[model samples]
Target chain A: MISFYPGPSQVYEKVPKWVKVAFDEGILGINHRSGRFEKMLAQVYQLLQEKLGVPADYTISFVSSATECWEIIAQSFVQESSFHLYNGAFGEKWCRTTKPLVAETAGYKFDFQEGLDLDQVIIPEDVEVICLTHNETSNGTQIRPSLVTALRENYPDTLIAVDATSSMAGVALNFDQADLWFASVQKCFGLPAGMGILICSPAAAARAEELQRRDHYNSWLKLRDNAIKLQTHLTPNVLDIYLLQQSMLERKPIDKVEEKVFTRYQQWSEFIPQLSGVDWLVKQEALRSRTVLALEGDPATLSALHQKAEVAGFTLGKGYGSWKKSTLRIANFPAMKRDAIDGLQTALLT
Target chain B: MISFYPGPSQVYEKVPKWVKVAFDEGILGINHRSGRFEKMLAQVYQLLQEKLGVPADYTISFVSSATECWEIIAQSFVQESSFHLYNGAFGEKWCRTTKPLVAETAGYKFDFQEGLDLDQVIIPEDVEVICLTHNETSNGTQIRPSLVTALRENYPDTLIAVDATSSMAGVALNFDQADLWFASVQKCFGLPAGMGILICSPAAAARAEELQRRDHYNSWLKLRDNAIKLQTHLTPNVLDIYLLQQSMLERKPIDKVEEKVFTRYQQWSEFIPQLSGVDWLVKQEALRSRTVLALEGDPATLSALHQKAEVAGFTLGKGYGSWKKSTLRIANFPAMKRDAIDGLQTALLT
Candidate 1:
């Protein structure tokens, strides 16, 4: 099948080969404490940094999924309050998960059609953490790094956490500006789901160490302690980590990979005007995600198109939650082949 | 190297081939919303129930890891009070993680060398949940089913939850007697880490549904609601699920698998007595685990043996936490070969 589903997108053709070797070599069975497993995980983290331009002092810990990252952040930090900015489903979901953290969390919600209005977002003086999504996969919106840099400059005491689950590999992230960044292996990484990579700055680590309640399995402090040994706090998705390592090895340097992905996204954006009965859902070009392209169409027509595409051996991602019928998301991750894109176009025309 | 690390035990010889086939067939990217993925997941659940003897009314959901299951259970069924029975590192860790349920959590510590004393255990009238580990991988002690059954009969109103992370497939479990049973794929299933299987009874389901503060992702109600459609409430470890499904297909009937594992354990039990300076850590044969066999020895001597075994191409599991230096854990799961066991014996003799 020509898979175009967002998040669990198509992986590199070589990934399966490496996974087979990983199992054959008994890498799957190696104890997480063994030198071999530790080396592998260290290499994975190294490659992740190389591919994403993460700072040298930053540490990456593998957890279950991006949703778990939200829990870990809430459980480890934000003892008092957090400022959550929500523009789409994932951000809203992140805010909902933080209900257990404090009596009341301050949140700013924006319409799907509107970009995050930084001026309208009120961060309380005592809010120690600011949570937002770098890319809103559900609505194909992107939050600019400049806004985050501004947030850090204005609210120097507040820690910035970004969920870049769908945009990390597709766009260039200014990791140095964000205290913490997390993403699932699916989405822009173009791999199957299961693992989440959490990139933590030294500041976040210090904050985690100070929090006495950070004792959960996926808690930042626990993960940070284990990560020092290049091991997860629990048995991680070993095979998935191996596949992600392979993908990172095959990925061009960050700038090149980002340029390639952004170029394809530009092609898709330009093509939207040529297509009849479909319009770009994200209003501002700067606010649109390079990896997930959201399109506005009639509910019945979109459903009909989805059925037709599947029958023609192409699979398209469904509009999520509130956008369930009115919008459709197309993934433009690097792993998607030109032929698959052609197939999608052909199916659409028919 | 010869690998014998417990609970991330060896994979079956056919796993690589099956994983390759799964990837080649595009099963890894199968639309989770489609009937194909649902059918595959349903088949997996059906096979798991048939092989493990889970009741027909029970429901199963795939999670990222068994550790994730702890969060799900604690966040879902645990409201008023939970009594945790701890005998090993994992059990203690679980209690620590669930400490936030403090308004409702009571921890009962036990000697790691002895089996649970049901009569001495105090279950407060307000304690609505009782959590225990079926097999303490850290110490190679197994909780007897008969003892658990008695506890259930006495506290009929309390929810009985078991973490069978290291024991499920290696031993026979009476699933009908437990409110919830969960295990990771890395253990007796002989697959890579990442996915956990959770089986829950209707009683547990009702309690979760009644939780007023149920958050979406970790909420058991959402998981069960999604499981009816053979889908995960959040993105799952798709490739690991495929790998686990393959492992389950290759698993022998539970009775037969248990017999083989038990026989191996008996051999180890008989053989360990012959070795100088080595003794069974659990003391009582009835309390010993069939899969993870913990051997007591001098701290220096055990450390030397670990180094020697690694040089001889065998990787042994270290007794977890406090027992790390004084004990050696031998895994006797189905994936281990007779040659590997014989090699371990030879190494010990040398």
Candidate 2:
């Protein structure tokens, strides 16, 4: 079956071949500190930079998952207070997770249905970090890239950290807008879900070094320092890294992949609105995410629709958080095939 | 090649089959909150209890790695000062990592050559947690189980946490002796590196609840609460967990595995002492680890010996930390076959 779950959704078709390559190469047995691993890490960083348009000076580190990124940012950058601009459950989660670590955490919650209006956002003077979710998988809302640019332009001194959990690879992101960008591999990279990629600007690295919180194993400063040598502070998921590298190698260029994903999402969104008893979660067209599309319907109706799709050999994502039963979320990840999207359309339309 | 690198050293021979099972079963695509995942996690916990003697009152949680465990424990359990008894790099790393998080972290370092003697340890009144490394993978030393029992008796109020990273599955640990036990899957479990298992005693859970440090995603309270439903606080490494479950399924009973490991290690240890220009790192026989065996010798001699074994289709672990060039380490994990060990013995002896 073709899986369309939001995250940890689907593996790339080429992954089985890559897994064989990893096994044949004895990838799991390589010491994390060895020259071979260091070389592999360096290549991955290079690939990410080339594919994602990450700045040359930015440092890339591998973490366990996107959730770990929240904790690491709190420990490394949030010395005073953080302003969390949230539109959904995941955004609120980021604020709540940071509340205890920092002295203060202020949250501006947007209406989940309407999503965030960038012009209405206010950045407090004492907030050292501004946390934003690039795409809210829970509500299918996305903060436009222009807002990221606006935030950075307005708050030059404060750090801008974006959780690009669901859209990093499928969407073309302007890496210059944020000081830190993080995503787990499971979402758009079409790999297994054990590792996360953390892209940090030099400015963010400086902020972490200034904080000097040397106690945690994933010290942002240490991660940065070790990252320069193409190594991690811990024994990372080597096989996942290998798989990610191989998947990246096997895929088309990022721009082409993003175009393919956007084209399919656009087609679906156009047809979804025309369907009976179904509407996009976000009222604002521009605010709706291209990757995670949340469709509104009655709870039982949505469940039946999900079952119908499943019987047709297509798995649509379940609605998350408060919308768990009332909505059907579909992931338009890069790994999603054209036929699967067509099948999903056919199953729903019929 | 027969690998002897300590942790992340080997994948069990049956891992390829298990990985296939995971892929074919679509294990990676299941939602973490789904009943299927909950059932799988429950089965894993049950398997662990039956095999490892983890107490019924203990809560099992899965995290990314042992490094993450240090941060979680420091955040969740350490209310005030923590007394760290360290013998080698990993133990010292635990203290160093905890020093910044707690109110005060005190470390008593044992000589790397001599290893830790728990009987001589002194606990300060302000110390709320006593941290020990059940197995110091870096230096091939282990704290005896009796020491864990004695410490629990002596410091009834102080919580005891053990890093059983390299020895948990290859040896029998008394769960009642420690408030928390954690180990990465790469070592004794013979799985690829990516995830760790954290066993928290009910008393430890109580201590975390009393502390109430719920700011982080991996707060012990949050982890414990989620674990009752057989779920993790964040997205876990689903594939690794499946592999671990499969490895456990293929293994003999824990006691039997432990016996086989110990017998093989005993035979190797006997021959090791007789080798020309080679001696054990720890003088005390009881402190020498059953899984990871570190041997001291001239740097050149060790290098030549390592080369000889490699030419004979074997890979020996290089000494870690300061002994990187001067020693050869051997791992006697349960996954290591008898013939492989005998081959190494023959290659070294001849």
By lDDT, the best candidate is 2
Chain B of candidate 2 achieves a TM-score of 0.96
Q: What is the lDDT of residue B120 in candidate 2?
A: 67
The parts of candidate 1 lying over 4 Å away from their true place are B112-114, B273-276, B299-312, B346-350
Q: What is every candidate's C-alpha DockQ against the true complex, given to 2 decimals?
A: 0.58, 0.62
Question: Which numbered prediction scores highest in DockQ against the true structure?
Answer: 2
Kindly report, for each predicted structure in the order presented, the TM-score of its chain A compared with the true chain A: 0.96, 0.96
Model 2 TM-score, 2 decimals: 0.96
Instruction: Give lDDT per model, in order.
Output: 0.82, 0.84
Q: Top TM-score: which candidate number? A: 2
lDDT of 1 at B213: 49
